[model samples]
Target: MSPRIGYFLSCEEYSPSQLIEQAKLAERAGFEALWISDHFHPWNDAQGNSAYVWGMIGAISQACSLPITTAVTCPILRQHPAIVAQAAATAKVLTNGRFTLGIGTGEALNEHVLGQRWPNTDVRLSMLGEAVDVMRQLWTGESVTHHGDHYTVEDARIYTLPDEPVKVYVSAFGPKALEVAARIGDGLCSTMPEADVVSSFKEKAGPGKPAQVGYKVSYSTDPERALDYAHELWFNEGIPGEAAQVLSSPKHFEQLAPLVTRDAVAGSTVHEADVDKHVAEFAKYADAGYDEVFIADMGPEYEGFFRFYEKDVLPRIRG
Candidate 1:
């Protein structure tokens, strides 16, 4: 298959059943994979929505037939390594061996539950390194016995493991973490979708490791309406905070439709309605040498978005 095309899902959407239906549609639409977000709380005052990620993913497994994994999940702080390993192993089995475990150090908002300490990025990455190490040992059916900077296991073994190794995809933003991904992970995941990032990651990760980037557009027949929703639901992702670290996607506020104001929507997607313009943004990442790009549309114009993507975009770049 050519470099993969995928669909994105937010764990916070209203109708998870609808989300599952969308995944089936994506499979029928020729999408290669599905990436779902992992979140704990929505800060109702801000985004006004948040759904249980693993539960939703379970629904996706039952409702749709597609390869699935979280775009990125924090295994270090939000949950324990053994728990994550067991859950991921089960998911791999449930998905018919089509699951990849994408992980990251994580953001404070999601990790600070139960009053656990939220370390800085460097420390968090260090923790993740050890966490992955622990999970790997457990997944290997080994009676793990180790003491690391952040985690420890005592004769632990996952009773259930997939027949095949569960591909571990790591989310990295900068140089140091990228190097760690190269040395340890099976693949790299990033939101930047910049070619430079992919090349840098591959160099440190060495050859043959998976490198996937995610990008989204507000696809709609009417550019204006899509852009409006982009500002509302998508724009907050652009906000500057610990929350924004995970949501590194950028916005060209000045370049988009000038009329859409800050008050109208949570994001500046008013200009995203133009399918060509929207896909053009995604192409920048593809050109950057990413092996896959997962594009999630913000509004209901999914069919329209898929048509434009398959006809206008895929023909030109997909190999």
Candidate 2:
């Protein structure tokens, strides 16, 4: 099948209503699907909003017919796997079996908000494995009592399940997490356009499993202004290594944001006026073997970005 192109809704920057509206706009624009960030908190002070994702999914289900996927949610700490299973099941039914549960080991920003200590990557992966097991077992619609190393589910059953099982996509940026995703995930979700990651996933998960990727673009007629917005709102993205995953809160990110140069953010995100440049950036991900490429607008405004992509970008990429 040809790769699908979708919109990446940044919940941290848009209200739930706005996100649903954007989903409708995306569908009207002929986009194939929607990917929403599942964050409890905004990355920094400038990008100011983080709506409850599950609630937004319910709204999006009513607003549009596009399939939905969480860019990545942590189902281990902030929520248990059993609860996630129920939520996914409900989401699937609401969207008419068009929902995909994209999950990850999680970041400190979202998972640590409940005052829980953030474990290292290795430990989190272990926890994620157990959590996936719990969620999958519960999805069987049987009374599942799972007492695993990281989670315990007592006589749990999800009654409101869809006809087909909700697809579970696991997010990964590193080696260990990649292995876990390949072994247990229904598909793969990632933010970077790394072909090696795809190679690794397909190598282990077999060649036919889906790999979905997300990329950020600060699309504006004015490239310089777009670059400035990207720097302000997503400079935290340029934080190298596991810092983006390990930082406990937005303040911690803010403390390091100044050190991130505008060029760094510009380099990380596609801050461009040229529609061709945006199309090429997306092509890289699709060419890298991603089954789906979800592009997020990093600029403050969405109308221009949406319009430009709808008119100029999507068609070229879809072709």
Candidate 3:
């Protein structure tokens, strides 16, 4: 089957109104879905924007018909699972069943804001597992009381659930968490174009489940400006392993970013002026078995990127 093309709404860099405008543009440009980042803080101070994701999502529901998914939210930290379940249920009702709750173990950058000690990855994964279970129970439209190792819910129910079950997609970057996603999640959310992860998820989740991947690239008429913009905004993207997960703030991330080599950050993304090159980069993920591929243009201008994509990139890949 041909893969679905989607636009990623970068909430860290755009205001709520801009996000809604981009959502409308993306739908008009023939993208099939929308992925919005749910974050309490921007990765770097230079990015300069962090709108509340839930409020922005409500605006998106009214502005566009495209299906929406949080690129990944952490219900395990900063918010209780019961609250996450309630908010997700309302989103599903508002979007008329077009919402998917994409969740993850979370990063210290966002989760540490509440002044809680950041737990290690293993504990976070355990919390995420229990959280997903709690959410699923509440989505059944029955009052639920859950007391797990990480969280507790007493007499909580989601009255606003849609007729269809709200799909839950789990994001993972490693084997252990991938296993958790397979065991509990309805779909998989990831960033890498690694086929092995997709293969493993499909094998473990059995058949007929979907996996989605989001990738970043910079598109501009000026190749040099594109590369510079990508480096300035996402140099920290090259931070290896779970380092990005543990860093507590954008200042910490900024300090570590300069150590990342240009090639390293450029390797993490496609920073080319050519539309065909951008299209090819996306095809790599689709060929890797991602059911949906969401692309974020790291260039400062969204409208130009959207126009270039609608005129060139979408047709080649969506075909």
Best by lDDT: 3
The list of candidate 2 runs beyond 4 A from truth reads none
Question: How big is the positional error of residue 150 in model 3, measured in Å on the Cα after superposition?
Answer: 1.5
1 against 2, candidate with superior TM-score: 2
User: lDDT of each prediction vs. the true structure?
Assistant: 0.73, 0.88, 0.88
TM-score of each: 0.86, 0.97, 0.97
lDDT of 2: 0.88
For the record, the alpha-carbon RMSD of candidate 2 to the native fold, in angstroms, is: 1.2
lDDT at 177, model 3: 91
Per-residue lDDT of model 2, residues 64-119, tens digit only: 99999998889989988888899999999999999999999888989987888899
User: What is the Å distance of residue 89 in model 1 from its true position?
Assistant: 0.6
